[model samples]
Target chain A: MRSVALQKGLAIAVPALVFGFLVAAQWATLAAPGSRDVGIRYIDPLTASLGRLQDEQTSLKAQLADVRAKLDQLQRAGAAQNGTVRDLSAQLDDLKRRAGLTDASGEGVVVTLDATRAAADLTQDRLPCFAPDLTDIVNAAWRGGARAVAIDGERIVASSSVYCVGGTIVVNGSIVSAPFTVTAVGPTSSILAVVDDPSQLSDLKRRRDQQVVDLRIASVPAVTLPAYGGPVVVRSATPQ
Target chain B: MRSRVGGAAVAAVALLLGVLVVSQFRSRDVYSRSLEQETPESLTTLIADLNDRNRQLREEIFDLQLRVDRAQSQVSGGQGTLEESQRQLEQLEVFSAQSRVTGPGISIRVDGPFDDHALSDLVNELRNAGAEAIAVNDARVGPRSWFAAGANGDLVVDGTGVRGPWTVRSIGASDVLYVAMTRTGGIVGQFQLIYQRTRFTVTRENALDLPPLAAQ
Candidate 1:
């Protein structure tokens, strides 16, 4: 009788357990589709999200580079537009001269004069005329009307000089052997008048009387003034 | 046999359902591999294409950098030229203004009655006489060139080379300059060359041309 009761209990328990398992499995199947674990199928959602972030970073960097390039272009354009701050003619001429592009030679009148010492030109038994004689010659030249003038093939600016001490004549602060020729561009009448001045006459007379150095004057109608070709050193001058 | 066959058919259907259920559960596996299909091929293609584009861009950048550098140097040189030209023009203008004169003027030339010493003394007198702008020989009448005597007997004044005709011509009021030139120690009185007839003549004239002004 105990064996039959045991057999009866197992038969009933076995069928009931099977039915419960079926119902549980059906519920599990319905829930499995909507779970977070579904994200693992086909592609790992986390890895995909990481890949998207990397792509975004790359895109952002490219944008930044583009912006930087645009900014640089704009700055360069602004600098190019800066206006000239000085007079153009002066600027061009100076630049040209520095580059050895000067057009400062032409047909002009040439003046030649010499200095000789004598007794009458002296004062207190001493030589009274000095470098001032040179001054007289240049002034006369200007009065004669010269556009561009030079001494011994060297262009003379406002800063050029003539220093005479003892027996030396310095031109532009440099000693040069001379039968010095001063050239100018203008009509011959004014040039002749300049040559016929009184101071020049006196210097000639003194040279003849005392036989100081040597005195002579010659006026040339056609003389080609050569452009000065030397070191093109330049310094800025204080503006007036 | 027929009953056994029916039982087998049902068992087969149940087995199929069990397999389907297991497959569904496998699809929801949390421990799935991170690897994806065709990963290497896609990455390789992307890398190769990007590298090509990058190389082209780098070449362009290098060329542009060179061009920009050259342009910069050119601009710098141009600016320097502009500045130098301006300087020359200003110097010319100053000269033009100081030398312009219109009217009766006096011309005085004194190189030396006897020697360079006589010329120097006359120079002192000329300065005392209020002479303006002097030069000797081919040299100019600058602070350094003043009193610079010509080795070949030439005297420069105001950049004009004067030899014997040490002409000093004044515009307008040369009388004052002349008066000052002839002071007791001036060339008019003390210069030995004047006494020796070293050629000293002072006269008033409407015009005169000792020489051309030096041009630099």
Candidate 2:
């Protein structure tokens, strides 16, 4: 009778303990930060919203291009008929070029930044390429007297901003991922001088040394940068 | 007989636990697979970018409509074509940092030891807040303007050395710019966080003038 009772206790206790363990494990997994629950709850809606916005942007860009083409045609026709208009057109073209409204190509330096293998490892806490990192590279090129600058094909303009939305970097309202390529058109030697200097780009250099980021800088004879295709609105300031 | 019945009951309980564990594991696998490509941070960023893009698109639509009107006027030989062109040129001149601009805006006076990175971040924050024109000390901030550390730890804006007690003037809507500068988690707050000794005095002015870029 005693042996039978002991076996009965063992049978019940073993399964009960196993069931409790399983329940606790499942609960812990669900309750932890960055768990499946959080990911599914937030990511799905955000991604869907992003897709809709991108679609809207594409449509708007198409409309803007159409209007711009029309304006160009009208200006060209006017320039052909009137000398004053022709001169004004030339001046406008120069200003537009200066304002980054037109494509530019010249000798300059190209800096490419990529996350290293270490950064790819999930255990690493720091990302080698952030908004500030890209901003620093762009600024360094400008300090070296770049005529025009583009990052990942988005032209830098007065109103353009480089910022991080999350882990991704954004420039002029466009999403850009690494490996980020910063192309600057100017005096090649001067641009390279600043971009390659460790003192000037200390943060990037530190990361490069740590194998966090792979940074490559080279001078090219000619690099073409696309025009500023983003909005050009001055809603606040009036000429004073 | 009692032992046999107990064994069957234990076997049933084990099978039920196995099924529950398997189901939970399967659900977890599906959830992780769905989220493998994106982290929560990345997803949040995507949402913010989308919102910003939509706002920009709205602004672009407004600008394009104006351009269309201008083009139609020019095509019809309207007398305002030259005036329109001149107006557009002036706007571009201000935007390209080729001319002086004055408007209601905000000025921030910062007194502390800060690096070029901080200053650049400040300028970027102003731009993000829709500053039409910006100037640090006397140097105009342009599209190509860059801030760097000068010799002796001085801040250099496009090669112009500027020390502490830096005054940053921006041209934009006074109220909007003011709120942006003073808001929680704004540039001023961020600066204070990083530079503990920094003092930032932000004032909204009815009229502030910003000079053009110095001749290069």
Q: What DockQ results do all the predictions give, each relative to the true complex? A: 0.02, 0.26
Q: Which ranges of candidate 2 are over 4 A from the true structure?
A: A1-39, A122-129, B1-45, B78-80
> What TM-score does chain B get in every candidate?
0.38, 0.74
DockQ of 1: 0.02
A1-240 per-residue lDDT for model 1 (tens digits): 978755655555455445545754665555432232333353354336435543543454354345434433433442354444334444544434432223344345665544321222222122122344555455455556555566665454433445443233444433333445566654557755765756443664565455443444555556655433222211221223
Q: List the residue pairs that clash in candidate 2.
A: none
For candidate 2, the docking band is acceptable
iRMSD for each candidate structure, in the order shown: 39.4, 9.9
Winning candidate number (DockQ) = 2
TM-score of chain A of 1: 0.45
Query: What is the lDDT for B73 in model 2?
Result: 73
| Candidate 2 chain A: 10-residue stretch with minimal lDDT | A120-129
The numbered model that scores best in TM-score is 2
How accurate locally, in lDDT, is each candidate?
0.44, 0.76
Lowest-scoring 10 consecutive residues by lDDT in candidate 2 chain B?
Answer: B27-36
User: Which runs of model 1 end up more than 4 angstroms from their true locations?
Assistant: A1-87, A90-107, A115-130, A198-201, A205-214, A227-237, B1-72, B76-216
lDDT of 1 by residue, B1-216 (tens): 754555455555555555555545443332211123213333344334334334434443454355445445545554322332333345433232222223344566664534444554444444333333333432323211223335477654443445665655543346665666555665566554346666566666554322223453
